[model samples]
Target: MEHLILTRDLLNTSLHQSRQIDFEIHKTAANVTRINHAFPSLEAAIRNMACKCATFGIRNHVDRALPTVSAVFKVSQVVNELGKLVSTHSASDLNLYLSLVKRFRQALTLLTNTCKLAIPWVEDVKLFLLDGTTDLGVGVDHDHPYQSNVCKTLHLLEELQGTEERSLLDQGILGVAFNKLEDEFRRLLIHNSSPLQVPSYLFSSGDEESDASDPLPPPPLPFPIVQNLRAIAVCFACDNQLDQCMSIYIKVRSTIVKASLQGLDLGYLDISLSEFDSVQEIEGYIDEWGRHLEFIVKHLLELEYTLCHQVFGQLDVWTDCFSKIALQSGIQGFIKFGNTVTKGKKEAIKLFKLLDMFAALNNLRQDFNRIFGGTPCSEIQTQTRDLIKKVVNEACEIFQDLSAQVELQRLTDPPPDGSIPKLVSFVTEYTNELLDNDYRPVLNQVIKIYSSWYDNNKFTKRLVSLEVHNIVKSLERNLVTWAKRYEDTGLSYIFMMNTSCYFSKHLTGTNLGDLMGESWIKRHQNHVEYYATLYLRESWGKISALLDNNDGDVKKRIRGFNEAFDQVYRKQSGWVLCDRGLRWETCQLILQVIIPVYKRHIQNYLALVESEVSPNKYVKYSAESLESMVTCMFQPKLDKYENSTKYTNLMGKIKNVVAGRFSPTTAAA
Candidate 1:
């Protein structure tokens, strides 16, 4: 019975030991099970942390979320460690490694979506992804292939999500970005503000060792903001969103115009000649102004071709904007310049400068037309016309003043030679010089004004005629004084005749003849004839005194007559007789009046001195001798009166009558 009790105790002890061992094994198994189950919950915790990280990264700070992101990566590493444990323990049924991997992918997806939401712009996203804060290998070890996969997958997902989100975001906000960019440009250009600078990395030239000989870098390519805006505009265009693109284009074009015009110094337009001492200085200023305008216009045209057309693919809108600016700034500026030049005291030199300014403006207009391809702007045309009219009217006033001076001189102090000839020469020279210059365009229009006056009331024609008539009247008065100043009637008559002839001939030769009517010419001719007749009568009256038939001492009378006729012929031959007809008629009248009386006296003398020994000496008073003397009495030689039909007829009648009274064949009847 004792032996039985010992065996039972031993069995109980052994049974107790066995039961403890079994309990230890079951506790180990349960703890293993709990450890195995904790991985999924840990994955859930990691995933929750990753989601929180993504939310914080996107909503709060992306570039500054590096610590949080590092924590998430640490959690992912923990997940990776857990995954390895599952693989090492042969726990395939739980699929812990796959679950961790799948959870990590979810974390990566969250990270990628956070990046996409945080940085929408493609360029910004690229920059953010490259930034050190977003490094995916922050705490991830390469020993775990899953972590490396997560890192690479995170990058791939970022790329895919970034590309997609960028497209939608760009499409949605393209117009807004472009408009903001244009507004900034407008503010800079219109307000003349400094431009914003771009980062070197974004706009690197890659040519840091620039050639020293190269020209200054072109104005920094449009600011990066503008660059980004332009890129978006192009994207919009590609998407058939042309209206938004055009809107941006127009805004940019207007800003360019404003910028170009702002570069011009419009103060030069108000320059005054009084500020300059000489025309050359004014010309220099004008040239400088022109150069400035050219520079501005050149820049504007470059923008139109290079930027506007390339970006917007249209030219008309830009050209139209350019036209308005050109008219407003360039043409109006020149117009004001012209006004300034013409404002001061009227001087011929200043007028010429104004004319030069007008020419420059015309040339500029032509250039604009060639570049812009249209008719001259209306403002330019209108301003040009106004300038022309002002210049011409100023010239007319100057001319009128000069003409008045000439009239005053004539009225106040009439010279012996008369001022009419002086006036004629002056007017001719003035008109020729004016017409010879490059003022034809204005002069042509001026002529139309004069023509209108002529057509309306004949005012211009009458004014010209009146001026010429006044001149002639002045000449006639001076001539009358000259004629009366000389006491000798023959001398006075010769003077008057020559003077009148010259005056008439001069009138016919010059333009004045047209102004003076035909009646004036006839009146002058009559005056000349009357003077010539008076000269003939006065000159021959002395010779007629010695031809009396009743005087005693016929021989002495005939000898005295011969001596007097010789003295009178010598004295009168030197006088001027401009008209051939007047001279011939004077000679003929002298012969008619003197020859008949001389012939009668000679016949009576011969009969009275029939027995005288010196009859040949007294026979010098015959008709043939008188005819030869009278023919030689004028400036140009004249034909003998006896060669004329009237003289021959009178001689024939006299000869027939005398033959009946005395013997025709006797030396002394």
Candidate 2:
């Protein structure tokens, strides 16, 4: 027992010395060189201690051999220190440092093998060796310092007796290191407070122009965060953990989207455009939000395509989130927004905004296609087109309603201007502006709607032409109704002629004119000509009928003819004949149709009257005086008539009879 106790005492002293050397080595770099010189001596002492402990029968001494256990733990401590020191060695000095490492590792192996009793503290040495081999660090750049260290350590570990143990250590250390990196990234995201916030102007003010020029603020997170994330992704991809790397990427992209949208005030998205000041305000908000979305998606796709396929394999999570977020905050929001902005607005204003909305949708679809470049935004495009169709339909409804209201007002109220109605000016201005803008899409849609109403199964040019024809017919009906409202037939014909001329001239000048075709325009012109002829027939035809000598009573006939001529002349002279060309043509027709017959009738009547007692009383005037009065029929200002050749020849014959140059028998011949 005394011999055994002395051996244990020597073993304890050597273990104490080994531990002291290890402490000295770890204490300073100056001692690392000095202590490393003492490692050979320390190795000898630990080797002797292990041999003595092995001779003591480790199993038999397990309960009472506290010193034996302390020695085993001491060897573990020494091995840990040596591994750490080896990690710091330069490549040139690595062989020398590793020589010392080899001694300590050998001592540890001998101690464990000789003891035959498992030391719970032995795990510390194994873990230290694995860590030295892996060079795993908890810091941000975990792979930087440890790369060469891990290579060297793995090379050494592979040559060791415990291949299985080294493999297990390799896996465990890699997992822990990767997990540390993941946790750090997670903490970074959790702590990031740079989510975009809604601008105060978006919700608080109604100034569209002010908002339109408002510059978009930069994203909440700095550029470095993105760089760091990408670095981590690259590292994971390098490690062949692409799935895990993709997951991180997905999380990062989601966070970016979330941050951007947080500033958009998504709750206000459901608000109608009327809640704001104007369509421009809604446009500003949508554009602002769209810019942010565009920025994020652009960067994301750039990052994605730039990465290798192995790193970014058909990642849809980012795109899916983008689509959802953008639609929720932009397109869907605009549906109600469009309605509210256009609501209660003037028809022209409503048409402008709705068409502008369609333009915006077209631009957005193009942007989406340009950015995503695949089927990613296909659904969004389809939805956008559907929204455009809805806006177009709404615009058509507004147009139809405006037309109805104008027609209603025309029917219910007299012309405020007392000439052509205001509806003409309104329709004229509206159509001119519409065509001037070249809104062919709006025209096409309107035509489509009208065609659908006419015949759903057939959408031909004929049907569209018929629709236009119907619109003209409605106008004609309105004009005729307006004209007939006046009691005087001559005045009524003048009103119809004037209104029809104005309508036909304006329609022919517009794109609506093109759609109506040349034939339609000619039809309208013919209608104007028919009205002019009707005016002549009503006013001048009565006077011409009095020129007939059908009545046997010459005195009654002359009295009646004189009365009718005076009545027609007074009524026509007071009327407004607006068009100069129409008035001239009307004057020519009256002179041509009535002059010769009037000359013959007056010659017959005056021949009988010339023999009476009171010839002057019997005949109202001489033939020349009657000719002068007849010439003044349509001339309100005594403007000279430039009669055609036929009118000149006819007027000459009448003049000859009135001047007594031709006998009544000769004039009749």
The candidate scoring highest on TM-score is 2
Off by more than 4 A, model 1: 1-461, 499-522, 618-626, 632-669
- Judge candidate 1 at residue 467 and give its lDDT: 43
For candidate 1, write residues 1-669 as lDDT tens digits. 433453465456545644554454455345435533553453344354345446433223333333433444344344334423322332122234334434434444454455554324322323443444553424334444423333443443344344223322322222222233333333333232222222232122232433455433244235643444344444444435445445534444554455445534466677666533334445445545444444444444444434543333342343444454455335466556666555555533343344445455555655555445535345556666677566556544543344343333333322232112223323333333333335435434443464464457343434534543554555456456556655566777776665565545544534455555677767778887887678667877666777674566877778878887888777766554544565677678878777877888888878887787886776765689779878765552332322121121222223222221111221011
TM-score, each model? 0.37, 0.44
Query: Which candidate leads in lDDT?
Result: 2
Q: Candidate 2: misplaced stretches above 4 Å?
A: 1-49, 56-336, 345-353, 369-386, 396-410, 413-419, 424-437, 441-463, 503-520, 540-580, 583-669
Q: List the residue pairs that clash in candidate 2.
A: 197-263, 198-263
lDDT of each: 0.47, 0.48
What is model 1's C-alpha RMSD? Answer: 30.2
Give lDDT: candidate 2, residue 565. Answer: 74
